[model samples]
Target: MTLSTTDSVATAGTAASEQPRPEYPRPDLDRSARWLNLNGTWHFEAEDADSTITVPFAWETTASGVNRAWLERGVYRRELSVPMEWEGSRVVLCFGAVHHRAVVRIDGSLVGEHTGGYESFEFDVTDFVVPGILSELTVEVEAPADKRAIPHGKQRSIPRDDYDGVSFTPTSGIWQTVWLEARGRTYARAVALRGDSLTGFDVVVEAAGDTPADAVVVARVLGTGETVELRTDPTGRAAGRIEIDAPRLWSPADPHLYRVEVTVGEGESADTVIVTSGLRSIQARGEQLFLNGERLYLRGVLDQGYWPETGLTAPDADALRHDIALARDLGYTLVRKHLKYEEPIWLHEADRTGMLVWAEPACPSRFSAEAAAAFEAQLPALVERDGNHPSIVIWGLYNEEWGLDWDIPGSDARARAAEHAYETMRALDDTRPIVENSGWSHVRTDLVDWHYYEPDLAEWKRAVAAMAEGTQDEFPVRLGPDFVVDKSYYASDAFPRSGVPILNSEYGEGFTSLERAWHLRWETQELRRHDRFAGYVYTEFADVEHEAAGLLTADRRAKEWGGLVPADVNADTVIVVDLIPLRAGADILPPAEPFPLVAHVSHHGTSPATVRLHAAWLRAGAPADGQAAVAARAQPQSSTPRIAVNPFELSAGLELTVPAAPLGGRLMVWATDEEGDLVARTFIDAAEVEEPNRRGARSDG
Candidate 1:
């Protein structure tokens, strides 16, 4: 089932294959004069045929112009011309990412080899390149279909029932930007900056080649104009601290960024690297996650970072920005980048747009000594690469024990591995919190995270109550027990009863949009009820291959089942309703009995306001013309007495009754502000009539 690139209205203007992703790949270290984009069409070869493909799009996706999986080894060939202006400087070939492993050759001479698929790699092709002549560049990629030890994330070798709901199609070969950069012989290898005690930033700069005796590191903060100068040691390492009188914090409301320039030398021979720094601190304090010492409510979504046209990569930078904007429009302050490390542009947009990110590492499917060693070896570099992003507040080590397949949740080895990963991340960078494993079997983690997918709202409420009251062991059943060991271990025994903040990282697997919205609203409300929970991340932002439980379709179209806009269902203050006399989607209602309804009005907004409740009935099987149908059938019912609501207050047990009416009609319930503006609304379809006792009891009981 291959979807065409034109199916998405978002990418209708241009053929993704013709001009896919032409933007500058790296925004943080961008140098217009020193870098060249290598993301257009490239010569490609598979076992069967030689072809051309869009450079960054995976071979299996539609935008690549070859909508077939490159399961076997493939080769990418392109001609590179070193800019005449870069004659004396070193030429570096950089690949944003290549699946599994890659061997690079320049002008038929082997240059370098890299093994990780998610991290960026570069090679110095200066020694082999003829200064003014075009050089032949070849990249041989080996992405073994059956290699379970490689960190393939959700990519499967073959389609299976297990992946039908959550996993996505496999992506192979280059799925990110390819570019060339020219640098002087002595350049700043890397720059790292972290917020220092919430008042300033600590900067570290490393020089690439042999340092001259007069080498000194100069750091300049762009906005506030603070400068710090430090002399490098013999090895070309320098560290300095820059203090700001009044630090501007980064948050979802305002993502202020300060640009920093790090220079490795002085005068005409100086090499400089640009960096964007955000002053912020993320800490887990007693049952809460704090950003800059203030408690934060993480309204987030599970972002798979997949697109219909481009598979693992966005069709272009605009597509990436669109997803982030959609998430924000849906009132999500955070996005959990599930299983995949997205392109740097996505993170940069997140930084600029005030969206917090929970960055995760791609995980392997099977566990082994080799896999563990490989994962550990890649940890430091990965952290170093992404740690500078201000939007990334959390680093997720493992997800649901993907590679730790050896009796996880019951084996000591699993615990040891998780702790080791946590410690490894801590050693590399301590700027953010680390989740040892996201879903279950947590050991030595900064946050207690879990995954639950209860489709039934009443049952979900009960389960959350059990967890909040420390009685989850009594009700043993859960949405997916395998993801977590048992309710007992998760609620009490997973970690010490310390003040660890709990998060329902994954949930709401509904088959329909209405079902998804209802489940999301109720689950979010339940999590809000328990202050111990930091927040919840809905199952997904958009549909992936075979995973239809998304607010948006695979083509980025909004589903009708979702409310008019993101805020209609995901507002900070919203009204929740429970039909006491009818169940969700209940088609049959007793003709003689008056139907009772209960409402819970939760106000998270500031100030007090009066809220009014309204109800109406419309004939069943009405036209499906969306808002027109909804508006036509909305016959106003008698309004309820105005009730004053306060911020962060819950008004429960508000009751109303619907007089018995003819069968075969829909029931609509809505709430309004004092000015009669709609706040939220819900509807139930009634298609038949039944005796009171003949109907199943409400699940809310």
Candidate 2:
């Protein structure tokens, strides 16, 4: 029933307030249709910004109805008239978001300015417009045309950034919905809501305009139909708390939410907003993460939030929901909204579908007082806008020492900036775990995490085991031949830990899709073999531009994994086949004699699971398909019913005999539940030697 980009937006004189995305832009603070969607066609200008481009889609993307090569600056202009029905009320213009910096003007008069491209900003235009007259609205956007530092995130540009090939297309101009909403002359300017077990829900309201001395704030929980009321101050600021009977706890298995409606005043002048919150507690008490009093293992993937057609913006609202659904389908419990602070609609969907999220901001490429300030300044707005969602359990800051210049250990100023960011976020909200400098050197943090990409399977297992045991502290990360040696230390010298919960935030490698699938089992098994790890996020959820290290392509289509589903490797329970390489760190099993079949079984289920290990031999036609890595997901020529059946435990050295075929067959091993569902699997070539998928994917200087 959906159409292509041609029908995504209206053209020319079709200026109806209702755009393609008719839903309220801010679902978290839903005021229904008090807002008119201004996301359609807008007059655009720049060498690259087209004469006319579709709203909410970046100019770089084809969905914007423009063919832009480079995007650094863009000017957007449009004219709109207020609805005749709304006369005496205030008119507010809201930008879902614009990149880097936005300077807004009304009728050539300066209205307001906003920095940071990932968070929403608004301007009240009550005095600037006549109720029924058309007014000209213009917005000027600027990103790094040269090397002027800004939190660019994974956005790659010729001059602004060269974060390997990992980064993708830039998002410039108006990439999100722009709209105008009617509000009371006196309205709630801000609503800060938080939900937890201790307090059912707490909301603080900051109102605008003059308010009666006897004005009151009232909040009601729609689920339980419970309510709370508080008297407002003369300045129209009020705080209210609501507790419902038999509150339902929220979890990934069941994300029960408490939909709420908050009122600021009384009668016709009353201002009301709708938001959703959930009661849950997440803590890293021991060497594990607990969600709602239950232990959790975060099987997460790094989602870059880019698309081939729309670049950084979603082509449609369904696209946002699809990513979450795809991750869930791949047997992942969480999605790390990598680098970019993803759109609010994505978080809203995560709340409804019960998926965990790690929210982050775009990091400036270089470091300075300006860069640090710019980077940290967006935290409050980021938290204030998205904190109510139950899906965002972790707040991640800094990825692989990006904004800090990859020198946190050598510079105290950089380290202090990292610490200050953590402290500032703590001051804003202490409910979620904040990673000071995620996957780099943690000067201060609630969780100790790392990102190591090693292609050698043998070395990878050793490194993962050692790190999990708290032995390997230094992980050398060489950005390129031009950069100095940068090692991601387990912890900074100033903040040594007896050990906090460890998560491998970014890790995985593969030369080809088949090889990636083949090595996926090894890499996943290596991490899961260590019980100390809280979880891991694969290098990516989908490929971005040329950075082809994802299970899925940029278009959300599944990358060919040699007939293997990603869920096969990314599962809660896995059978980690333990075998000595024929040579050093190889994937071939010699055809000399019968090798001892051993497996280290790791299960994450609450109660033990009844499972069986199965072994088989697959004969290939030639040495072509199984040339490098092991052939995976190919039907076995013959099957061994069950090698061992045991209650799920870390059992190793299970007795079995697996002979390498003399002519040309590989040895296959796997684990299955009592019902014969594949939970874990891996294979070893019996004929050819293995080749490693080396890291340092790019060698660009």
- lDDT digits (tens) for residues 184-216 of candidate 1: 666776778887367888987777654534478
Clash counts for all predictions: 0, 1
Question: Over the full model, what C-alpha lDDT does candidate 2 score relative to the true structure?
Answer: 0.75
Q: lDDT at 658 for candidate 1? A: 68
Top model by TM-score, which number?
A: 2
Model 1, position 608: C-alpha lDDT score? 71
Candidate 2 C-alpha lDDT tens digits along 1-701: 11112122222234344464545667778776466677777788886435787788877778887757566788888877777666877788888888878999888899999988888888888888887777788888886554337777877766645574566677887888888888776777778777766458877877775463456778888757888887768666788778768778888878887788887777886777787878888888866788877788889999989888888888777899899999999889999998887778889889988999999888887889998898889988988888888899999988777878888888889888898988998998888888988886888888888878777777887888888777876675658766555465544566665557888888877788777776666788778777778888887788888888889998989887764557756766766777534432135644676666767677777766666666666654222222211343344433344444333246554555666466546556666667876666655555556567888788877
TM-score of each: 0.86, 0.88
lDDT of all predictions, in order shown? 0.73, 0.75
- Candidate 2's TM-score reads 0.88
Candidate 1: which stretches are off by over 4 Å?
Answer: 1-19, 158-166, 210-214, 473-494, 562-566, 578-584, 587-596, 605-652, 655-701
